[model samples]
Target chain A: MSRHRARRSGLLRAVLSLGLLVGVGVSGTMAYWTDQATVTTGQLAAGRLDLTLNGQLAGPGGSTTDTTFAVGDLVPGESFARAISVGNAGTVPLDYTAVSHTNGTLGPGLRWTVVAGGAASNAGSSANGDRTGTCTGGTTTFSSASAISANAAAPTPVVPARRPLAAGASETLCVIVRLDPSAPSSLQGATATATFVVNGVQRGAP
Target chain B: MSRLRVVVLNAGALLGVLCVLVAAALWVTGSRPLVVQSDSMAPEIHAGDLLLARSIPAADLEVGDVVSVVDGSGVRVTHRIIEVSESGAERIVRLRGDANAVADPDAYTLSRAERVTWVLPGVGSAAAFVDSTPGRVTAIGIVAGCWLAVVLPRRRAPLHARPRRRRGIAPVLVGAALLLPAVLPGARAWAIFDDTATVATAPLAAHRVVAQGQPQCRNEGGLFGVGEYVRLTWPHVDVRYEYRWEARHTATGEVVRSGVVQPAGGRPGELELRSSVLDLGLGATTYDVVVHARLRAAPSWEAAGTTTQVRTSAVLLGLGVRCA
Candidate 1:
């Protein structure tokens, strides 16, 4: 009985150890738990700092003119007044600085002064030749146009005023331009083309 | 005896004896074993290796000793001790992993048992399975049948035939070996359960500090208020994590701005801070910022985090003026 019991116990112990060893070996090989989760692609695209320039001009009897206007038969001291609206069409809050540049000889003799903040007017078309406006908002001077730069590459700001333009916000300005009265005879029939560059920078970015 | 047969039997008996001796020694030691759960201590101790550990005085703990410690989240972890600081009655210990290039994110208080005495490789997986529902059922059935085997013969023996004392202890020893892991602390979490769920603290917090490699907006100091993203952090398992945040109307719970944030591989206590300036553009409305983490581990690990209230002010871009 003693011999039988000893042999049985030994066999049981052997089998138990063998079973645990095999179980543990298989479990280690299985290696079930260590895992990783991958997140889907999510790119936080930065908001853009941009603004669009829209303008209209009105002359005698509320006649409107486009941005590129032919002041038809220009004479000495002939002037034009325009109501230009700058709109913030981008997703970020921004500020803008307007500058005037030219590749032609017409920019030097044309004196321009800008005053921002006027009620948006529909009395003039942004396409026609009516260059006079009816805006009496803020008296803040925006900028002064520069002398002509032939073949110019850079558009310099007339006045470095970064006017804050909130997202989807619009600003109307009272811009008045006048031709020099005491002009020389050599300036006759001189066609001057001026390009206004409106640059917007995200607020606090500058 | 046939030479090859004799050799084969001799080899089998030797292996059997070795197996029995090893199992018996493990059973008798009563060494509470903790399983390696992650690859943090890889190469030295692979995942699923059974580690037998006992607490030693922090003062006696030396550098380079691999020790296990519980983090703030109550997760058991093992790392090698690298530094120990002693000031008056206090001892502060710092630990790092052999597989990791950087040290642990947080230093541990010198009050925990960190020294490890023994390691039985790859047995933790088996122990874990045995601690499961089906495993327990099978173990109980085997134990009950073995006990019957020992008792039935004793009942049929003659009056002069007596059961020996060692035989009586053998079954008890086997029973103890099977149930060893069930009695240990911290080992219970590793055991498989039907639901396989866990309760965790809020995993996210709001902050105003800038995170590295994130774009910073400038106009926030004015009317367009600037704020940081809800930061999500964990105490263990360095893996790339995912989370989403939203700004919703406080009164109606309407989502105002929402987006997801995913940061690449991070270690314990490493914060995954993400906030988009465009998303934080709350306008003039007061909204609550709600964010949480999703650890999508097989069954997923989740946490319910807190919310923050933010209000934006008015702005006049034409006048270049910001209102309060």
Candidate 2:
């Protein structure tokens, strides 16, 4: 009994001493260099995706700076072309596209074709500063309108590499809207409006 | 003839088996170990420590993971990932040292696990030394000599040789000798930085100081972001800290930006020695930041009509365990 008691007391004493040493060591005696640093707590916001439309928007008016793309009256088989330029003002590159939505009975009688860099590419790649969004020699035409054509199915995309417009760069698009030459005379009094909607998203992540 | 002898022999056999098993497991896992050589990640990790890292993809890395990557010039750096940018199939990772005040001067591409998962302290110093040319030769000679001393003596002994009285002691001694390497020296370098008094007029009252004691035994990666800010403290009010900051080119290891800060006044709180904002310029090259913290303590005395002083330094006395 005494032997067991002695051993227990000794063990308890050792534990107490260890606990005391650990406490003292943790509370008061560091004589070495210590370092502490933290990153300021904040979330990195995504880059801006601002796309601007300039130049002539083909519509009712010939080449007005007006926001309304109003193509007043067009005789059957007549074709009208207008030059429009899209610029990326944001810091990062952007993927942009243009789509037209029509509302009227004559909507099916019209067809459109888009040619990129119709005039911008003439300046040459090195002729100016910040021309990342400038379009190359690429063209896409929508000949017929589907009965239920939504945004994606009817949109015209810029040329490859030109699709992602670089920051501070612009692309000039020449859109030709024409009334199909085979349109019947039954659509004479029908009026239609084609609204050009441009959409853009940043190419890479934040 | 004794249980003690039987136990020692069994323990030795067990240890040998365990060593082989562990080595095989590490090999199968494809994990590699590297030695740390600087205090850029001090407090969390230290110089003369070995790090076990597994191969992992850069895309899967998180912001706070400590990863090892090669800079543009092919310099291997271990730092925490602060930001990541993806370019096509590759990832451009930006790293920052924990003790740094800013981001790395440049970023690195992460394609492998070189990410640190385990830190084995003090033993790395011996491993590093042994890996060198002269050290390697000396180690091989010692191992070979020890093997010969044991095997040759046993081979020469008769098959029916008389039993030795000290046979039991031999196994115990041999077991102890083999277990010595795994004991691992407890001493590692760490410092305390008290930034509580940084605000001149109304300093924050106090910081919970974790008093790490002197290790009875003794035995050190990178990017940079906006520069990092670092702080170190002296426990008393009468101490001087002399610190030097060096920014070296990762590839050629040339010092580019170097400066030293020696505080004129001795105060009882942590000192902020570096600022977090860094101006590394826009370049693809990476730089490494190294800090040299030296503390000088002076106690006052009376001599003649003026007060004289005795200087004693309270520098480098803690185990590298807790992070400030």
Candidate 3:
């Protein structure tokens, strides 16, 4: 009778052990699968941006011209009053701002402002009729603004601007400048600087 | 005490034997099967079909033989031989799939390096499944069960007697039989060929002029180049004929000059001709001379002339001689 009872208990213990092992195995497998699924789905929401710049303008005073960007090279600073067209050929929208990083050292009458969307007619005057002052000694004051639109047939000039870009959209920003006769003679051939800030990221040359 | 110990030991031994058998089976037949995932080889093979393949001797291969070869990236491809050649002591073979209209990008040379063996029809799906997590778990469970049976005490037969013979052979044999399609053509002999020759000299002219040569044929009549000759070789054979030329006074190094030469008469190996021309052009100087040659291959005859294909290779010749 005792032997029979002992055998019954052993059998029950074996069955319970087997059940526990199966339960642990199943739960582990389920956890692993869940983690894998999450990782795969999380990878779907990422993107990147690519920027291209074209053309530069420079002169004794100030100048403007259209430009195109090519792969694997930077624009020289010799160009003044340049027209920069930026293209967004990436999968994400581009939020960008343009700034001049050079010290105010253009000629006595030199001033630089960005004209977004549209041609620069006077080359040195803002659409709002603002004329920047000339250089005092070696120092010239140039400012930039947003709200310039490359999509407009005629763009307005501003100091700081905000622009929203859809993927694959492009905009042309015109650099307008004026050179003062009182400015240093060496300033005539110096390279103007333009800094491109896209999606809060800064890149460019002065 | 003796009787009880004997019973327990016997049970344990039997369980151990069962485990070893299962393991041996899995070890032998587990890794050789593969599943088809694409319809690229349709008509002759389809997606989801199983393929069983085993490593075999390259010398045993023939032109029409279907073989599975792993490429540089480790992806396996099953195709028929289109050409074979030897360069010095090195043996090279070119392959193309039945469904493809063109041969592969480059010839695969296998001397003592690497070779492909025969391919089996459909049988890779199970192997693919076994590679997955769920299948792995099942396999682990089977192993654990065998282990448990071996480790448990058998002096007290739990309610029922353990079967005198375990049926472990069935699953293993079935698995191997399923993979048999991948391994049937174990031993076979293939054809041999002579080594290919290289050009005798560089064919560039000055810094800007290039001269080219074309293989001219003078049969019963006058001489003619590529358009006049109809070269033919047996099925599953690759034949290359070289032509040379030179160029003169080309402006920019980027300038490319292209032309096409086709076979004149339809011949048995005519449809299989593949051609490519290379401009060996030189840089700088006024005239960038270039000499070009075309390389062509015949289609595989193993498919009983069912498929027609052509391929080409080109080279530029020179970089000197100012045009202005």
Candidate 4:
């Protein structure tokens, strides 16, 4: 019985030793697994949207700076036109529109037309010695022959349709203004001026 | 022989060998251990966390799978796939950080992508340091030295000559050192990708129009019954103009004559006015003459030239009338 007891004690001791060693190994593995180091992933940044007219970006409320047009010496039965550049200067695509407002008595006799993909060219004077011009190489999008208000505070839509402009893309608009031949003779030698503003916003929901 | 001591020694050695073999297997499989570095994928994943990543075919990737891709600059970015599409034979993947509001600006085209297989929280820093060249070299040198201390002494010294305490601890130390490089060297470069797009300020635009006209007049005719006329001229004017004349009796404040000259066929800026013969009943009569002109054009202007200086001296009956 004593011999059997001695053998049993030895086996128990071996098992205890193995368990202790296994416990130590597990603890070490846990420590290594829990080991940490500092690392960084590159920063994630947000995108921006910019719409420009003639390479000029728009400010808040769809306003821009240092851009204006001046046309003069207009007469009855004559028309004048010019090309305005519209560009998308941002990284993302955008949609835009144009509006105009005129002041002075001559405004009532003036008619406006807008066409895309056109070039403004002076067509020389007519037989009656009146100034004349044309918008060549274009498709007319909007035109109105009826007289507008003499002094309109509210802006009139030059291009009622809103179109999407791809990033870094540019479009030229041929804007034409004509004086009615039937305008009353009392409107001579007067002046009329107008302002054109183009507004743009980021691309719509995808 | 004390069985306790022998058992302890064998168990330690066995544990050491297992650690070394496991480390070797991980290295041959090309598995990477990556450390999280940004909060772009927060909540589910966090900074300072360690991940075990495995290589997968690009075609096998699906939307919402977290992946790590190397860009042209050799920078590796880990993000979640928001979209997966095929372009010809190429695979295109669009990714975004979980914490970001928008997807990345540029899509990734790849043949293979790394997908995370396991995550060990808060073990990234240690693994990164150990995996680095300096850290790895230093650690390997220490481990090698420790291994030599244990093995060399055993080979040289007789089995009974070695110290009992030293034999019991040496294998455990060797085991831990071998495990160092296995867990720490999985990641080389990991970063969070950005999706930023900025817009510049817009400028102002406007247009203006104008028209101008000037007119002048002259009186060449005199006397009450002889030639009485006024000529109007406007220079540098292209549009047509209308003129009117009125003859008033200055003493009686009565308008005796008034006529409107409609836009007549003439030179663009010239007008001639002739008056009817006046009746003189043996008395001298004085009259005021006034002329007004205007043009029909855009934003028209009024042009009036007043000529109220006509007088009659002595007049006999019938057709005998003289004036100055």
Q: Give the number of the best model, judged by DockQ.
A: 4
| DockQ score of each predicted structure, in the order shown | 0.01, 0.01, 0.01, 0.05
Model with the higher DockQ, candidate 3 or 4: 4
- Please provide, for model 1 over B1-324, each residue's C-alpha lDDT reduced to its tens digit, 9 standing for 90 to 100: 122322222232333333344444444763345665544455677656677766667777778887767666554557888998885555677776665433564777866464678776666665565544455454444434444443443333356745534543344455545555432211411210000001111111111111222212222232332332323333333232344567676768878667655555554322322333323344555556565553322112233544555554434431111111
CAPRI quality of model 2: incorrect
> Distance (Å) between predicted and true CA of B26, model 4?
37
Q: Which candidate is the best by lDDT?
A: 4
> Cα lDDT of all candidates, in order?
0.46, 0.42, 0.34, 0.54
Runs of candidate 1 with Cα error greater than 4 angstroms are A1-206, B1-31, B150-324
Which lDDT tens digits does candidate 2 get at residues B215-314?
Answer: 1211100122222233334333222334444555556777666665454554333333232222233333444545444322111110111111111111
Residue A162 of model 4: what lDDT? Answer: 67
Model 3 agreement with the true structure over A1-206: per-residue lDDT tens digits? 24454344334323322432333343244334212222111122223334444412111111232222111100111113444555555455645544333222222223345556534332222211232322212111225332223222222324244454566677666554433223332432333322333221111100
Provide the interface RMSD of candidate 2 in angstroms, 1 decimal place: 32.0
Q: Give candidate 4's total backbone clashes.
A: 38
Q: Which portions of model 3 miss their true places by more than 4 Å?
A: A1-206, B1-34, B54-60, B112-122, B149-324
Candidate 1 vs candidate 2: the lDDT winner is: 1
The DockQ value obtained for model 1 is 0.01
Cα misplacement distance, residue A193 of candidate 1 (Å)? 45
Error of 1 at A76 (Å): 44
lDDT of 3 by residue, B174-277 (tens): 54344333211111111110011011111101011111222221212112322221222322121221222222323434433333333323321221111212
